[model samples]
Target: MAITSIFNDAFVLTWDFILTIVDAVTPSHPAGHVVPAGHPGAGGEWPEYVSPGEGDSRCACPMLNAMANHGILPHDGKNISFKTMNETIRSTYNFSPSFCYFVPNYIARALDKDYFKDTFDLEQISVRNDKGIEHDASLTREDVRFQPDQGKPHIPFINELLATASGKDTSAEDPENALMLTSDDLARYSAKRRTDLENIGGKLDFIHKMFGSSNSATLLRIVGGHVSDLRPFLIDERIPDKWEPAIRSRVGLTMARFNLTVLPLEFSTRKHMKALAKAKKSG
Candidate 1:
């Protein structure tokens, strides 16, 4: 396992170096036009939801899948260019222009594709290698050890996540109700998932753990901070009706802002997991 991890790290580093060179030489694509929120071209109202059918490509990432389902991305999930992905994500989610580019660049490096010329199919992002972007102990998908097909949602796990909000103050009458998962709630849940995977001999490495943490933070920040809003997005891979971008800013969410949210959550999750393991050992 140690040797494999080392190899994976080296491979990832090499890919990153290669991509840096390619990106340096590649001319930037013109910024795609942004449609106004709530307009026909924007993800707000007009685009009808369509379920992915036979031969349609899908991926392990729920957000991307949901985008494809909502027609914010190609319904067929094929031949997606970085420029298209960047514009769509920015317009739909209100992510910063830099963040929009950052994600596609990361995906390109992870999937070993050229960021400039090569278009990617969604299924290409589902590579199960340990160093790849897709990892085990996902919030809504079973680990690859148990289910090779990680592209589909795991209903049981989604149910477990929703259960965290069950007893909270979800009163519809109160506008400022506490129906959402707090940072601690999300951290505890993430710790539990990590522990469960470890007990089953499916421990995640540092890269995978960081990826999981980023996913959680993205859910908390980008997706509606409420668990109720997350339900359809996770279970059905559908964007909720009347959904609006949670964070609205001209600059949008930058890498620094995202890391500020993720780092503390990751630390808290690790601390909780350590406590759980210590308690188990003492018992």
Candidate 2:
């Protein structure tokens, strides 16, 4: 009986050791999807783009939608864990680790999701609220009051902004006709959008205006303010083929760097608004 008891204890210990080894080898969250070969994060080719189908969720943010379209996020746009978002954004865009974490946490808090464990469906971020990320006068979205389906791209509005690009660069060797949007172009476009929305009795409060400014700054920083690069992402909700972030740094685009970019735009936006106001007052 003593020998039998000793053997049972030994077996139990062996089984526990095996289980620990298995746990160590397994991933906490299985991807459950095919990562393309040689992809950045999990190693694979860039996933093919697919439009969101009926009952598949989408958000007002074009960046997230583009990521989902390319299977960087879940293609179905459902139950996206914050950790998954952080990892993918950092790998895909080479954004700062801190910024990547900050965005997801900000969304979770704004949308009232469980910051620690709650997963967000893409559509949840589309909710229009004062605190929510989606707001009026978006670069790729129509005002909430004007458009019933704010999740989809607003092509005409986007084209209008694209037309504001300074002009094609004759100096570039490759992509012979590369168009660039300057800081001035973005500021003017942002100011014009605000005024146009106001004319139509659309609401774009200070918070929303700041959000729009931040997005403009992100666009410039990530894609180098190139109209060619912006087109596919803004209009088609697809990442440009072979896209690499223009901002290359070990720390990536940090919050301080991002803020520095945003401040000038904010100042420019204010300047444009004042000019418009003065013109109107004089007229």
Candidate 3:
């Protein structure tokens, strides 16, 4: 069934915050009614498909079932997309979920309400080929806010706070500013990150700096994205003991995900982590 996002005004956004929000889909849904999983098998996926624009070859009808399931399908209205989904999630949450959960929901939430189509059963849709039987590949103007006269096609980043690192020139997208960290900067960033995690008080930028970048916190901030930056802590499991294994597992998964090079490599996405790991997307 199409699900109404529970992340709406949810003060407590744990991994479930995103698990409940992202429609049960992944960048991996080959030859059915979603983005064709770039690789050929269940084990295959473009690791680089992590960022937006790097690869977003969706089925054009990305959320047909989701729309029908929610009874908010857009064909009667329009269609859902990154822009539309971002708007949908934003219309309710005001901020993206941040970290790995940040991007999917950001893209899922961007669409205007009009694109929220009615849902349908997967069994009913014909999927004999990669494109499916009759899904329209053409995106309507309503689906995307296309400029009549193009100067430059500016598709904004869904997770503006998301820092991309694809071995490409990031100078144009994200300019590097030398940060002089004083004791004061450390104190502030440290304190803020703690509060957000413990639900006392905090700032998202604190998490951003830990990731070696500085950006405002939004729903699209995927804490998992920054896992690579935490080297020593993971080497020693420095996470606070009071945190539940579930929570610890989440941090570990986030770390493991971005830190894919680590040893004892996990062989499955379905195991060895918290439910939250499912929410993390490199993008």
Candidate 4:
């Protein structure tokens, strides 16, 4: 009974689940703010044997993926606990350009939500201070954050994109199956990317703009910009033909970030219908 709602629906959500999802979906990093609840400080890695540092037990840490993989209650109605699932998250993830933090939230939701018997109302989610500025100075420290040995200046970008980009920190022993998911599997996973973008488009758009500035452009140039894999629909062709060169200047973002746009109209409409039917029956 797999469940997926590209929108942020709040009906089936429990208090704990809703609180967690709220923090996960509305990333505070955009506001350059780090509240007591969560913060992405650095991209540190453990060699897997050195006394199994805090990373070993951090399934519920702020990064939505880690929290999803580590913190959420298992939906299988079994005794699956964070102690049991931490190893899986360490091994199930990988790093990539389009590998935004949103994927883990999707996987985590799947694990927590009762997909078969439950439905969510996507319109209920809300955001604050959505003026579209990336990395709100109010939330960030002007002081430098620690960076990995990887020689990149954008600590958060590197920590996020390069550090746990794969979402997993450990590698599978089975080389054949280690990160061996097919494009089909990736596409299925990739859908989460779109769902996440949709969930917090306002914040993400601002972050995308921040990265394009001269100071940060080089950082994004590597993984094709922060929001590199958007669909053609996301492309803003209206920039004056003259500024086109400036606005559409980067390499990775110059092309459509994604291969396609939203889920097919038919499927989306059908999902909505199914949701309505379920809602009516419940009412």
Candidate 5:
């Protein structure tokens, strides 16, 4: 069934977001027919012969099904389930839930690569095949952008920022004008990082610094894409008492969805350390 997207807002929608929404809203049949799982109708299970670029090859379709099953996407509208979607993701990616959950992220990345083709010449980018040697690959305009050098500055970084702000002749890298910080300043900064790592509130603040406010759209999209799987935390009673307030506060974000999406690895590391210590004591 052809699905029309209602996401026409100013928010930048990633390709995965579009696909997932489309899958969720689209009826199984044009005639609104619902087929059994193994039936040979439009609502039947996904076909077995799906090629890499067509039909079930796209990750978001299965994710949409998962969302529907978990009540994240309304089952009445699309009627797919998280279990069904999870099966498809596992079959396609051959990965565990932790890995398969990132399918939307992979899709977003691929779309980003294709989107960048318009800004940079993909023909200039060299890619290596299975042999580990670089080759031109004879890319077409329709090909995903393979420009590895795109991260390089077109001009000096400071100069570009200066041009945008004002035509200032000042350069930040100049040692003569550099302001030196004391040892106490460095120690205070290190102490603050340690303090942030010790609690959920500080960790959230750190996450905000990394990807929040104006730049939180991408992380939010990832969280939103997997809302069915992530939303359990909003209601789960097992979450640490100290972290409850912080998690609950951000549940209603329009574009800054899940806190876990931007959570630092150090948080997980701390948990691991605690577990290890507990095991050592018990053993």
Candidate 6:
């Protein structure tokens, strides 16, 4: 069964999914800031030894596609072992993005927890700070970690095998499938983009301000500003004059009620349902 199907049900809200998300977003850099660099074409000759085209491939990782081709990764996307998977990934590239480190681990844990019915005990460790006071940090067999290399950057490798297997495209571009969006499509995309930014900025800016400053907030501000630039192009007399503010207000209301405004509605609802289920079970 697909990982999504396993976790999609309200009754199936396992800790595995939440833990995987946590592991995925965790900083992989040695300094715990900035995503390490590596794009698709830099690492290896992914889909048969060839050269990168005019621009970088928009695909996630060629190495991952190569893994799927070689049968080192499971065809069914289940029954993965982190030790085995990590060794393969490490051997493939000398260095990669921090986010790439734990994705396979996350997939392995998700598959084990949901389909294979495996269990693990969290281990505790103590470490002393500069003040010489000790704090506890939980340890696990599976974890997110950084593999740093001061070299060329690459694209973050996503766990595509966990989702579905697709035919490896050796060519740089899939000519048959490469149709750019039209002007109207761009307009709609821009409108949606503007609304999303305003929502995210209005809701999170206050909290981010409270915490002083963060890379996350800075990035949001940058992206939000860019989206704001596209506002006039995307909206006009056809759209409501108050459309932007109204959308932001709706986002704030949703955030206040549910503590989420950025995620897609289906995903947010499912996440909330899962959290409620977890709370009820613990209570």
Q: Tell me the TM-score of each prediction against the true structure.
A: 0.81, 0.81, 0.20, 0.18, 0.19, 0.21
lDDT of 4: 0.25
Q: Candidate 2 or 3, higher lDDT?
A: 2
Identify the runs in model 3 with alpha carbons over 4 angstroms from their true place: 1-12, 15-41, 45-102, 114-283
Model 4 over residues 1-283: C-alpha lDDT tens digits?
Answer: 2234433323223333443434344422322121112221112221121111222221111122222222232221133333233333223221111222233243335445332333321111111124212222111111112221111123342223322223221344544223221222222222233333344542234332232221122222211222222111012101111111111211112112221211232233235435554665799
lDDT of 6 by residue, 68-177 (tens): 33343442223445554554444333222122233343443433443234322111001122221111110000111122211111212111111122223243265432
Residue-by-residue lDDT tens digits, candidate 1, 196-268: 9889878878888888888888877787567767888888888766666666444556666677788999999
Write one digit per residue (lDDT tens) for candidate 2, span 165-197.
Answer: 995667667773488888888899888877777
Off by over 4 Å in 6: 1-66, 75-78, 93-101, 108-283
On a 0 to 100 scale, what is the lDDT of residue 59 in model 1?
89
Q: Give the TM-score of candidate 1.
A: 0.81
lDDT by candidate, in order shown: 0.75, 0.75, 0.25, 0.25, 0.27, 0.27
lDDT of 5 by residue, 1-283 (tens): 1122123122234533544444445443222122223322223232332112212111112223332333323333232333443344333212233333343332323334332122211112222232111222110111113334321212232122122221122343554323322222222222233333343332333332332211222212322212222222122201111111111111122222223343433344345446554665799
RMSD of each: 7.5, 13.1, 19.3, 21.5, 22.4, 21.5
Q: What is the lDDT of residue 243 in candidate 2?
A: 64
**Which pairs clash in model 2?**
36-44, 36-45, 37-44, 37-45, 38-44, 39-43, 39-44
Give the runs in model 1 whose Cα sits over 4 Å from its true position: 1-43, 166-178
Give Cα distance to truth, residue 9, candidate 6, Å: 28
- Model 2: runs farther than 4 Å from truth? 1-45, 167-171, 175-177
Q: How far out, in Å, is residue 66 in model 1? A: 0.4
Q: Pick out the ten consecutive residues of candidate 2 with the lowest summed lDDT.
A: 28-37
Ranking by lDDT: 1, 2, 5, 6, 3, 4
Please state the error at residue 266 of candidate 6 in Å: 22
lDDT value, residue 81 of candidate 1: 92
Error of 5 at 182 (Å): 47
Model 2 residue 263 CA deviation in Å: 1.0
